[model samples]
Target: MIRVEHLCKRFGDLMVLKDINAEIRRGQVISIIGPSGTGKSTFLRCLNLLDQPSGGRIEIDGEDILAPKANVPALRRRMGTVFQSFNLFSHLTVLENLTIGPIRLLGKPPAQAATTGLELLRMVGLAEKAHSLPDEISGGQKQRVAIARCLSMEPEIILIDEPISALDPTMVSEVLAVIRRLARQGMTMAIVTHEMEFARDVSTRVFYLDEGLIYEEGPPERIFDHPQRQRDRDFIGKVRSLSYHVTTADYDPYALVGKIEGFCEKHLIPHRIAHAAQLLAEEVLGVLLTPLAPPRAVPTGQIVASSALAGTASTGPPLTVKVTASPAPSGPTHPDIELVLAFSEKQRSLEPRLDGAGPPGNPLETANLPDDFALNLIRHYAADIGYERVGERNRLRMRVQSIAGREAVAPIPLVRQCGAGLGGGHELDSATDGDPTEPDRFGRLARRTPATGMTPHQRLSS
Candidate 1:
């Protein structure tokens, strides 16, 4: 029953809500979620004229509330707001807090307001605490009393601004339960909440605000599961990433490893999985990828680091290593890690892909590589691996396994060439040497290759 077009709110030099356009239809529950300082609360306040908009139109049931000579007080009576802090009168009893609004603002008789107030208290499950002072009840009870007070005005729409943010964690569920009941009974609500799961479950529409605008808004599933924008995805914790570029073969692998470790620690990835990620980066960059670089001669007295090779002095195409960690679909404690290696130049002629489709005299077999230590090590720690070519770039993707019990790792499958019409795949045998029982320092089974005269753990260390 409310339509906001090009709504803008500014506090001095700070622009809070900018060009916001949305409509709150009857019985629609729209949840506004975003990082703090994104003006979610300000947008809600502007709806009821608590914060005056700097520009644009706010129409309530065909009446322009922001227009000159508009009945703002009358417009607000049709909407009720529940603030983050419980704004109850400290001296008033719970029933009085609920009845005072309808009696004073709507001019209802004390007897009728009292009857309606107690019914709302009972509806919110605070009937027994009707006579309790505001200070006597817990935070959740006070918020519920505040909600009932809002309903006592008999508002057509409710604007709740982070109602449970100030409450104790144990008390949060109770307040949310009351809001959920109201939503079920077809109450129109615009909730500003940080409770991601609650918003996903209760909201018919979800708005993700960023940079002082509605960045994305859609059904809960689309907004939460498949956010179309990067900021939206990051805000909702769908995926977290760390990226680095390697131009020359002399790029600092240690610095890249440090970044990977920091990202893992920040996201609470398990120690074993984090170590696997580091190992993957080391082997993929130092071993498999370094050989693909165009051969370059080093000057006798010069050393090159990544930072020193920037701008005009850089050579060859850059390889970007992007490590993305996303929550596992199975809801495990560890997130699923995907390591993507994108080569700016296609490597069709540089290195033989693990795609096994080459002739019998392939370079991989003839190069005396000591049983392909790097590839075997990658397969041991990876749940799946694939290769694809996109335009000029050849991308290799690997999904790291959570090696707690070794059950998450699947058998090494055929590496299929995908994207850009590169088809067909070649199957590779499982790299297991029938020694899956030995645990290494990283708490994973040490795969020992007799040809290499070393275990995977020793290979990693060496």
Candidate 2:
């Protein structure tokens, strides 16, 4: 239903998109994934001529959607876009929001438009919220309503830009369910998303983009699971540029599903309950543009002291602290989420001080500075203090501190930051005795050892 040929877009000196080409078959979903700033959204916009491309062509049903004689508005009415931020009119009622497109553009009678609006609301599971206003509903609900508004026009193809990126994890399923419903009905779709799993579940084909062009294209299984290109892997790792779409075909159209399934099986990547839980939490927290450096694994029982925690001993659960990972499942995805409820963002930036940024102004004033480096204002600081480091290889151990059981003397959350190390990884071990339970601890795949089973780090200590 949609075709993009050698599409390109540039803003001033920055080239956001380049030489992009793809087709969106009716009733199939296409997702474009890549790292931040690679022009995924720009590509989507240029398809509808929302962002005039510096070059290239877009077609629908064999007609140029971007050509001058094209009925652009009519074409757009066939394509709906859902934004990361719910761009609903705050002043409009839910009913009003969905009806605006049909009544204004389709010139439908208000009563008919309203009836259709209510049906769309029901389609997206927001029929009850129709009388409510944007602010009155949660972000997830608002996005659903936004999608319903888009569907209200009964478009042939849809363009989505991070629609679920702002939703909470649990809420993400609700929105995704609605989208899945749409896909099943055979609507053509082009979506740009960082929701890796969702991209896997629904897209027909996936495109891996980098530096303004599609570096690679394959089934979602390859793009999401075993991406062939390094740039594709890095894009998915750092910030995915995934496009899972398929060319319009009349025959067996489940090509995207096969790719996703194949990749999942090869990687031993199971859709485990734990994986689902992690994805859910991510919706609550948000992902980062760049992965946070692995926290150095100080040996267990080592204490980190922050005066800030001196009084945080409320008889409750662990204070929220955000943990970050590379691949994500679904939800509003900020790289970082407010976490370790007791710890503040200021404390998280405890890298060595800049030459002159000085104390980050507020909260630190009440706590005692690390007396040793307190005077070194220009020196940035990062420490693996209590975490044990193997004598050789830095043998980085990724530290994951779940709010384990609390003791009366539970140590205050101390500050730790990664600095100046590009190639680093940490081991996650089941045994605190310095042995990783699984071979690949936190993505640090075990390196081959000689006949001896022990790592060099262990051998040296022995």
Candidate 3:
């Protein structure tokens, strides 16, 4: 167990940790979360005397570590620290990295240390890499080896400072998975990390620091979802907006929908608008799953007949849909829901040219109409739509009115034409006699079929 009393750390005239007081109990996992340069890592460093505290008392197992007579090295040995950089000796093999500390620092026999090192490597799921050099392993693997080396000392508590921060996007999960396992096995830890979602899911207690002080501290649900402080809310919102990324594969539609659902729920989306927004996402994503027929100048009335019937199971890569909530327009009272769907990079003979879709005018008319199904679906559900080529990906931006603005209309219309009032609601049960494909809960066609039932605009007037 450890305790901090009036903890303070300063570099010259600049204070990094100010009058911080908190307790870390045995077997407890505490996460320190905050923006960069907020003293989160500094607090962790001060705990182990890696950075001497300017003034304050830090007691570990009833001994004040800052005392002149206290054995700082021995006390620190009881706690292990994992840094952002792997910090493994480049010349040492994985097994050597783990064994060297125990043999030299603890004075254990080389044979005993080697056995313990092998066991620690096995615990971190890196037994096979024991012979590999630091440079031979991946960033994630090296981090895992770092954790294993820490365990080789048999420390009572672990200090992890952004253990996954240096890893590639693809390697982060592996290292986190190792840490998560350690937590499950009851390893006491104090982590300073930018992994908010991981901390929310794993931490027993959360310390949200701001300006070198614990601005808010509590359980993850309270800190992450229902923070009592305005700054906390703003921080959480900014983090959420920047951190969300989800990929929806061609055959699996639920992946994207699930992400949207979780995102909307987290943002406290209104019930009426939430349902409509989700429906809009489902319809748009569903249309994207199917392959579009080559573009042609089809008349408005025959649009459904010409393009809607040509969509089939696409063999191309899946779409990646990213949704983020932005501050509402200059005069609007609610947040703006923006959805950006990124298509595959593979060149295709059937791909429609972005410039050839239409001329500038009303979005419903001027919007890209390469695929009638997608065009109609967006026009019916979104207030704005635009398309462009970004690098190797084709990106589409879609926006819709917040639920607060449309809750008065029951069974919200699928499409509200330019300047049209919300009237004649379209029912989900419309009979598509011409096309046998059944509509989903969101009224999206189950398969490539002619748009039979009443047209979105026609239903708006009835």
Candidate 4:
């Protein structure tokens, strides 16, 4: 019913919509979504000539609405628009609001317009609110009246721009329910919305706009579940902090490994990074389970103090881990894939001194006894490590870098799972005595060991 070809809309030197082309068929709902200011609303406005385009053609039924001689007003009458705000005449009653457009524009008789207005109000479940003024009704009711007013015109297509954005959260669902009913009744719609789930559920097609271009468009499943572009994945991750968050109290390092593996496989993370991530999770959680692990050391030079009762403590504060997989920041210096692991510990630990002298010593150097196991595992699997104090809690972080293979590339893929790839991991059994129930014991995994597992500082000098 509507065709927009090579459409471009610009304001002054700023271009909003560029070379946009879309077809809105009867009963098909196309949703435009993106970060704010990408021109979703402007594109919707351009469709109905509410905002004149800078270039290109807009057609309805093969007639160019952008033509100088086009009957623009008449064309607009054939399409209804619902704005973000409930744009109802405050002086008009709900019934009158619906009838005025039909009576004024369509020249329908008062009696006929009234009859149709009442029917539309009923369809929107606002029959009882027909006599209420705009301010006299809730935001949702006002929006329903606005929708019915648009329907009273009986347009072939509806353009809704953030229809529920101005409504209260409690009222959003009410308005969405009405829109859903309209979709079910075969009313064609083009919407600009930030309501992700709603758009995914109702849209026949989804358009992701960025920097004045349709970056991606497809069925909801493809757009949401399998975004092929790096920008798309980054945008999705930013919008949805989609990560694996787990708190382990019983110190089941293997259980955490299972969770990490599942998340990586489901998200299609490379096998190498997934294996390294799983290994890292096991190593971190194992330390929490072991009673022999040193008490959180207070930062006081090389001076180390111990809590006597800590030796008898059976359990510790819950260990919380959050892992997020995202595209690395783009630059000449950043890698392609970044896996971040955040470990939050309630107990105190010696802060790694920047001056390079301390009891726990520099994490850059050899780990003292038990600490050696974790530091070794992480050094072998991950590319970088960091530690900081968050409030009273200590947070240990690790970042694994996996670079994409391109013409200009760096050979960096952390610990691939296969027998002879990246970091060939070894068992933690070699790091500790072979007692599975050892008080200070952590867990281990089997993978290729890194060619350089020990840091230079940890190496024995001849």
| TM-score per candidate, chains pooled | 0.63, 0.52, 0.55, 0.57
Better of 3 and 4 by lDDT: 3
Write one digit per residue (lDDT tens) for candidate 4, span 1-462: 888888999999899988888777888988888889989889989889999999988899999999999999999998999998979999999999999998998999999999999999999999999898999999999988989999999999898989899988999998999998888888899989988789888988888888787889898888877877645644554422123333323444555566666656665566776676676655544333222233344332221222233465425332111111211222112111112332212111111111111223222222222224354565555544554433433345444434231213332221211111111122311332223333211122222226644422222110
lDDT, residue 12, model 2: 96
Query: Best candidate, lDDT-wise?
Result: 1
lDDT per residue as tens, model 2, 1-462 = 888889889899887887888877887788888887889988887877788999888888998977789998888777888888979999999999988878888889999999999988988888999999999999889989988988888877888898888888878888888888887787788889888888888888877778888888778888877778646754555421112321111212244334434433444333442232233222111111112221233332222332335576645332322122212222212221112111112222111111111122211111222121221111111122121222321111111122221122222221211101011112211113224344321233233266765543333222
Pairs with steric clashes in candidate 3 = 380-414, 380-415
In each prediction, how many residue pairs overlap at the backbone (N, C-alpha, C within less than 3 A)?
Answer: 0, 47, 2, 6
Judge candidate 4 at residue 4 and give its lDDT.
81
Predicted candidate 3 versus true structure: per-residue lDDT over 1-462, tens digit per residue: 999998999999999998888999999999998888989999999999899999999999799999999998999999999999979999999999999999999999999999999998898888999999999989999999999999999999999999988989999998888889999999999998888899998899999988878889999999988889756765665533312232322324466566656655666654555455556565544333222311344333221221123375434322111111111212112212234321111210011112112122222232233333444444445544555544434444444444443443344322222212122212322424224366432333434325544444333233
Flag the better candidate by lDDT, 2 or 4. Answer: 4
Q: CA lDDT, every prediction?
A: 0.69, 0.56, 0.66, 0.63
Instruction: Score candidate 3 by TM-score against the native.
Output: 0.55
Model 1 backbone overlap count: 0
lDDT of 1 by residue, 4-62 (tens): 89999999999999889998899999999998999999999899999999999999889
Lowest summed lDDT window (length 10), candidate 4: 348-357
Q: Highest TM-score, which number?
A: 1
TM-score of candidate 1 to 2 decimals: 0.63
